[model samples]
Target chain A: MRENLLDVENLTIKYKVKNGNLFFNRYREFKAIDQVSFNIGPSETLGLVGESGCGKSSLARAIVKLVGLDSGKVTWLGKDWTSSHASTDRKFRENLQLVFQDPLASLNPRMTVSEIISEPLENYRKDLSVLEKIELVKKSMETVGLSTSMINRYPHEFSGGQCQRIGIARAIILKPKLIICDEPVSALDVSIQAQVINLLKDLQKRFSIALLFISHDLSVVKHISDRVMVLYLGRIMEIANVNDLFSNPSHPYSQALLSAIPIPDPIREKERKRDNLVGDAPSPIFPPSGCVFRTRCKKSTNICSIKEPREKIVKLGHRVACHHVSDEESK
Target chain B: MNRLLEIKDLSVVFDTPDGSVKAVNNISLDVDRGECLAIVGESGSGKSQTFLTAMGLLADNGRSAGIINLNGSDLLNMQRNDLNKLRGNRIAMIFQDPMTALTPHMKVGEQIREVLDHHQGLGKKAACEIIREMFNKVNIPEPDRRMEMYPHELSGGLRQRVMIAMALICKPDVIIADEPTTALDVTVQAQIMDLLNEIKTEIGAAIILITHDLGVVAGIADRVAVMYAGSIVESGEVFDIFYNTKHPYTLGLLNCSLSLEKKIDFLEAIDGHPPNPNNLPNGCPFNPRCKNVRDICREEKPEIKIKKQNHSSACHFELGVK
Candidate 1:
């Protein structure tokens, strides 16, 4: 079996929000991410799929230490790094990188492409000379399909796809073992998205880098992920291999989400058996007791509201969290 | 042809400091009553600008020249007062972001009532009754309670429903929904699309859907117009666009999209980025990225030629998605 590059256990995150009524000094805790646990192996991709405001971003941030973790244990290469500080955990910081959702906003407009790409080098590669840094930047730009001569140009001069290439270049310049691509290609066109996704796959093959690809799109996630995790209201609904998850989704939420995706073929779209969620997700602040998705589940029962269901193995490796899900769900 | 809305040779050019950028080139299409025609393209493809110009909404520096004949009336050359009288009555627009389109300070019911008030001159009680009925028709639960709430108090899905209710309040002959579901989640997008399809059948009004997603087009649109660099590269029935796509750009688009219905190890991506509008290539705007581009493609542009009974393409070579 491949070695685990990263492991997370019982990760829980909460934010403090003031009650709307000002008559009393009272604050409530909003659980952004509940006790979630998952792992990624070397050179493997763990796809995180969820709707907006579902705590996918929060969990990613917590892993890289961008946000403060309320309680959790994140182990990096068999070492605990969750409570570690930035100055002391330089190796961990250098090894994990982030590619943001908005290409234009994530990149600095005033900074040149070379400078934006080389910033990580400056932070982590003080040992390399100016010539070595320039050589490395040129090679990295070429790896992402950008011309070496365009390094001196600014971000505003490039298109959305080119800007995202710059972002990927910056993330990979350090040769980080793990790259957290948060909706990396969602901002680009379909053709451009294909280009970027292919680039990421090629780079991963060359560098053997594990990817934490987060996106709301089921189709894009299924394209590049080794395993997929479904999140709802700060909790995991299901986690399975990409093929198993897409073909035989066990959780009711997963079934509904997969069905809601608009297939490209007209005949397939018309003939597909669609399972739509009844309504929008309830507020994260007041998430329902027991199962977070019980309010929207089609097979919801009295037991769903009274008791929280733990993760159960539905297949050889697939696990799902739902009271209504049975072994028959995998069939 | 019994077309409700017909646009001929529609072009939009923005006078910029650098140069005049052609946002929408000489493009033409039509919509019939009780049918949905979707214009699908990338961000800079000018699909939205084509319909925006029809609604008499263009930036100060932009100029448009086209024959937008709606029910035999030239909407492009119509006087401002006359067009204003028809707008929100015979033709309405739904923007991408419902929050910005809706007034935050006003109640949802009053905002919808204003449409009926201005167009039909209905009394307050009469307007409220019709507005509440519209809310119910759009599947908004607790119509009375929702009518009193502000835009922020409602969810993203609900707010879009209110916008649709307002747009259909006057029962326009044509409704231009520009990327209406782009901002919503997938589940919510399905809900909104289902609601829209239901309403279209009930009202028998033509729908012009502008979006960048081909998946959405496959689900709801009867006909598809694939736009590239401000011009329509392909126009055909939805079946033709999905199953028998002809244009190189359309083929590239169909090949690149990831599918949940099937698994693909790799994607056949188009090589280069879309050309800049101000400095587009001389021949085919997509020649820079087309794999089968020839020397002649660099010298001259091709016009939209008929491919089938109801299908047309604007490509020099015979390109098809395999």
Candidate 2:
């Protein structure tokens, strides 16, 4: 068995919102992410899937300490780093990097490719000389398929795909053990997305870096992930191996997500029943009681709306949070 | 079948400081009544540009020399006033971002009423009643309550629904939705597509869905046109295009789409970025990226070659995917 490189337990996040009229104004807690827990092993890729406004970004920010967590334990390499300050968690920060959604916005326009890539190296290592830094930057650029000579050009000179390469270079310059990629390839064209995904896989295999790949796209996530986690209203819905999850999704939410994905072939589409999730996703501010997905679940019952379902071991290693599935299995 | 829109040799170019950037070059396609024709390509493939130019809606710096015949009228050379009369009345367009296209200050009901007021000469009371009915048709729940809400008050999906209702208020013969579902979530996208299909059939109007998503194209398009470098490189009946893809670029696009049905060792992506419009190559635009690129491909540009009764391709080497 592989060592558990990261551990998260009972992670709950909330924001304060004002409620009621002027005279009866009261502060109410808005739960963006409910009690969610998952772990990533060494060099493994954990794919987080959900629709928009589902707290995936919040979870990502919480891990990087960019935002404060309400209640949870986020341990990296057997060390509790959730409550740790940036200065105290310098080593952990170096080992855990984040690549954002938009590479154009993430990178500074004034900064050249070399400078953007070398910023991390300079921050982590102060003793490196100019010549050494240049060499490191050149090698890192080459790793992401950019020419060393092109490093002098500014970010605006490159295309969307090339800019993303620069972002990947910056994230990996420190050789982080874990990289939190939040929709890194979603901004690029399909062909360019393939190039970036392949580059990521090659880098991960060579460096054995664990990846927390978050995206709303199931196809792209299924391509590179070792295990996949489904999230809804800031809670974990299902976690299973990539192949198993795609083939036999246990959660109703997972099934709805899988069915909604438009397949390229019309023949296969005709054979498959349209798995439609009724109603828009419930507001995260006032999520429904019991199961968050019950509001949209086709198989919802009286018990589903009344009682919150806990994650139950469904398969050999897979776990799902749904009372419908558990009840069917028991019967 | 009535040809609602027929575009012939549609070439559009934008004048820039560097040079003329060819946005849409000699592309010919037609949309029939009650048919949903999807123009699919990556960004800058000129699918949207071609249709936009056909509608006589080019930017200030852009010019077009082509035949944009709409319902037996030459829309391209029509006077601005004449085109304006036809634009929102006989033909309507829904952009990708409804928030930007819609006014934030106006109520959702008033937006629909404004469209009617501009073209149909409807009074406030009549337009409001029509707006509420259109809202119900678009499947917007609590139609009356939502009528008073601003654009900001509605969700992205609902805002798009409002845009659709407003666009279809006049029951235009053609509806051009440019990436309508691009910003929306998958579930919402599905809902939108279903709604669009239902409305197109109900109104008997041709729908032109401009998008880069091949998956969406596969789902909704009766016919698919694959564009590259400001040209329609391949187009055919949906089944032929999906099962017997005839162009290198089209095949590459099919291979690039990630599938969950079978495990793939690697995604087959077309290498290299698309050629910049300003620095276009001499021959076929896809020659640089085409795997089967021959010596002839680099020397002469190939015209569209009709392979089947309904399928055509613009590649030097014919796709052997029988």
Candidate 3:
């Protein structure tokens, strides 16, 4: 069996919010991530999908040590590195890279494309000379489909798609073992989004790097990911292989999310029955008592509201967190 | 033949430091009563600018030349005050971002009341009654409580519902929804699309939906018009545009979208990015990226020509008959 490259165990993240102005100062903790756990094997793409404010971004940030974890551990290559000091550790920073959403906003406006792509090498590779760094930058640019001639151009000069290519080039420059891409193509147009998705796939195959792909768009996730994980209100609802999760989703939330996506084909779209979950996601600050998704879940019952469902292995690799689903599987 | 809104040879130009930017080129289309016409394009494709000109909402530096006729009356030449009277009364516009479109300081109920007061000259009690009904029609729960809340206090989906309510409060003949559901999540987007479909059938108002999502367009729009670099490359029935595509750009868009039906190994992405509006290619804006480009494509621009019944394509050659 292939060993896991990254393992997250019972990871919990929280943010403190200050309520009641002026005289009475009251601070409350908002639990953004609730004991979420998953693992990614080397060279595998694990797609994390959830709606806005569902803690997908919080979880990604927590993994990279960009955000503090209140509880639990993040194991990298079978080594525990959950301490605050890990953020500054050279080995951790070099092996784990991140590609952000809003390509233009993520890149430094004043810096040239070359500077942005080679910034990692400057920090991590002190042994390399300036000339070597320049050569590496050029090669990285070519790998991401950017011409070396445009290396001196600023982020504002390039289009959104090209700007995204620059972002990809920077993430792949260090040849990291794992890269977490947070909504990388959501800001792009449909045609341009396809270009960036294809580029990521190509780079992944070439470098054999594991990816923690986070996105709200399910169709894009389905296209690029090897395995998929569904999150609802900061908790894992289901995780399985790409085909098994999409074809035979065990969790109710997974089924609703899949049905909500409108297929491009008109005839198929018309025939598809949509079981849309009503109402917006509840605020994480005041989430439902038992299950975080009980407020919006269609299949919720008294047991779903009384006690939180434990994660159960439905099949060899598929795991789901729903009381009814697990009961049916056991029966 | 009973077209409620007709635009003829319309062009929008904006004066900028770089030069005059042709936002929307000479394009003509019409919408019949109770029909939905979708304008699909990427950013800067001028889908939004087309209706902005129709509503007299273009910026000060922008200039438009064409006939915008509504019910046989030319709107381009009308006075600002006259146009203002017709705007919320006869034609209503729903913006992409409902939060910004709505008044933040004012209460949600008062915002809708202001529209009815200005357009219909209704009394306070009458307007309040209509506002409550409008809120319920759009499926906003607890109309009384929601009406008292501020715009920021509501969720994205509810804010959009309020925008739809305000648009419907006027009972306008033409409803132009510009990317109404783009800011919403998938489930909420489905809800909003379903709401729009319900409004189209019940109110029988001509709806013009401006969006980039082809899936949303296919589900709701009766007809589809595709734009590329300020020109309509193709306009047809939804079935024709999706299945029997003509323009290369349109084909590229359909091919590029990741399908939820089946997994595709490699997406056939369009070769290059969209051309800069300031420095578009001479003949056809899409010729540089077209796979079947010929010598003539770089010399003469092709006008939109009808290829089949209710289907038009702006291409030099027939799609499949090279």
Candidate 4:
């Protein structure tokens, strides 16, 4: 079996939300990520998908140590790096990187392309000379398909697609083993989105980097991911191989999400029957009892609301967390 | 042909400090009653500007030429007062972000009431009745309670529903929805698209959907127009544009976009970025990135030509031919 690059175990993240006026304020814990567990094998792409408020971003931020974890463990290559102090380790920081959603906003407006790309090197590679750093930055830019000549220009000078390339250049400058991308291409146009997706795929193949890709667009996730995880209201509804999840989704939430994606073919789009889920996702602050997706699930029953279903093996590499699905599996 | 809205040789230019920017090059298209025409393009392709010009909502630095004929009336040359009377009454527009488009301070019901009061001269009680009915039609839960709540109180999906309700309250002949589902989630987007489709058939109002998402276009659009560098590169029936594509730019767009229908090893991204409007290429705007470009494409600009019945493309060489 392939070695696991990153292993997340029963992770839970919560935010303290203050309610009422300053005089009578009460802090309530809002669970953003609840008891989620997964493992990413070396060079594997795992797509994390859910609607907004489903904790996809929170999970990403927690993994990168941007947010404090309420409970659980994050193991990086057999080393425990869950604490905030462990994230400060230079080796761990260099081996793990993150690409943000908004390309322009994530980049520093005042910094030039070369400066932005070389900042990570300055943080990690203290032994490298200035000339070597410059060469590395140029190489990274070339790898992401940005022109090396435009290194002196500011982020504002570049287009959206070019700015995104600069972001990728900065992320890959350290040659991280894993890159957690949070809605990376949601802000870009369709055509530009394709370009960035291709670049990521190319870089993954060249460097053998594992990716924890988080996105609301199912079509994109399906294109780049090897394994797919479905989340709803901060809870894992299903985890399966990409082919299994797409071809035979057992969880109700996954089925709804897969069916909701609009196909590009006009003839197929018209004829295909859509199983649209009714009502918006309930707020994460007060998620439903037992199964978080039970409120919106069409096949939900009394057992789903009364008891939280444990993860059950549906097949060799497929697991689902739903009372209804578990019952069917047993039968 | 029962054309409800017709735009003829329309062009929009902006006088920027650096130079003149040709935002919307001379282009013409029309929408018949009950038909949905989708304009697909990247950010600066000028899809939004074309309809904004038709709505008489251009920026101060922007100047528009040519005629926007809506039901035999030239909207481009109309007076400000006359245009205001026609806007939101005969023509309605739904924006991408409902939060910004809606009034934050006013009650949601009062906002819809204002549209009715201004256009139909309905009193407060009559407008409230109509507003509540519109709410029910758009599938908003608890229409009575929702009308009194502020825009912030509602969810993103509900706020979008309110926007749709306000746009439909006017019962206009044409509705120009600009990236309406861009701000929504996939599930909510599906809901909104279904609602829009149902409303289209129910009211028979022509819709002009301006978006970059080809998936959304394929679901609802009767005709598809692909724009590149402010000009339409291809326009045809939805099936023709998706299957029998002619323009290289359109073909690039389709090939590049990832679909849920199937998976491919690698996407064929169009090389190079879209050309800047102020400094477009001398010949074909897409020649620099086009795979089928030839020496002639670098010398002379290709004019829009008919490729098949009810289909047209602007390219030096037809695609799929050696």
Chain B TM-score, candidates in order: 0.98, 0.97, 0.98, 0.99
> How many angstroms is residue A329 displaced in model 3 relative to the true structure, after the best TM-score fit?
3.1
Over 4 Å off, model 2: A18-27
Model 3, span A122-227: residue lDDT tens: 8899799999999999999999999899989999999999999999999999999999999999999998999999999999999999999999999999999999
Q: Give per-residue CA lDDT, model 2, range A1-331, as digits (tens).
A: 7678899999888888888886998888998888889999999999999999999999999887777888989998988888777778777888999898998999999988888999988888889998999999999999989888998999888889999999999999889899999999989988889889989999999899999999999989999999999999998999999988999998989998998888888777656667777668888888899888998998889988899999999887699999988788889
**Which of candidates 1 and 2 reaches a greater lDDT?**
1
**Model 1 per-residue lDDT tens digits across residues B118-140:** 89999999998898888889889
Give the worst 10-residue stretch by lDDT in candidate 1 chain A: A322-331
Worst-scoring 10-residue span by lDDT in model 2 chain A: A270-279
Better of 2 and 3 by DockQ: 3
TM-score of chain B taken alone, candidate 1: 0.98
Q: Comparing candidate 1 with candidate 4, which one achieves the higher DockQ?
A: 4
Candidate 4: list runs displaced more than 4 Å: A21-23, A84-88
Error of 3 at A105 (Å): 0.8
DockQ for every model comes to 0.82, 0.70, 0.82, 0.83
What CAPRI grade goes to candidate 4?
high
- Cα lDDT tens digits, model 1, A53-84, are 99999999999887787888999988899877
- Clash pairs (backbone) in predicted model 1: none
Local accuracy by lDDT, each model:
0.91, 0.89, 0.92, 0.92
Query: Considering only chain B, what TM-score does candidate 4 achieve?
Result: 0.99
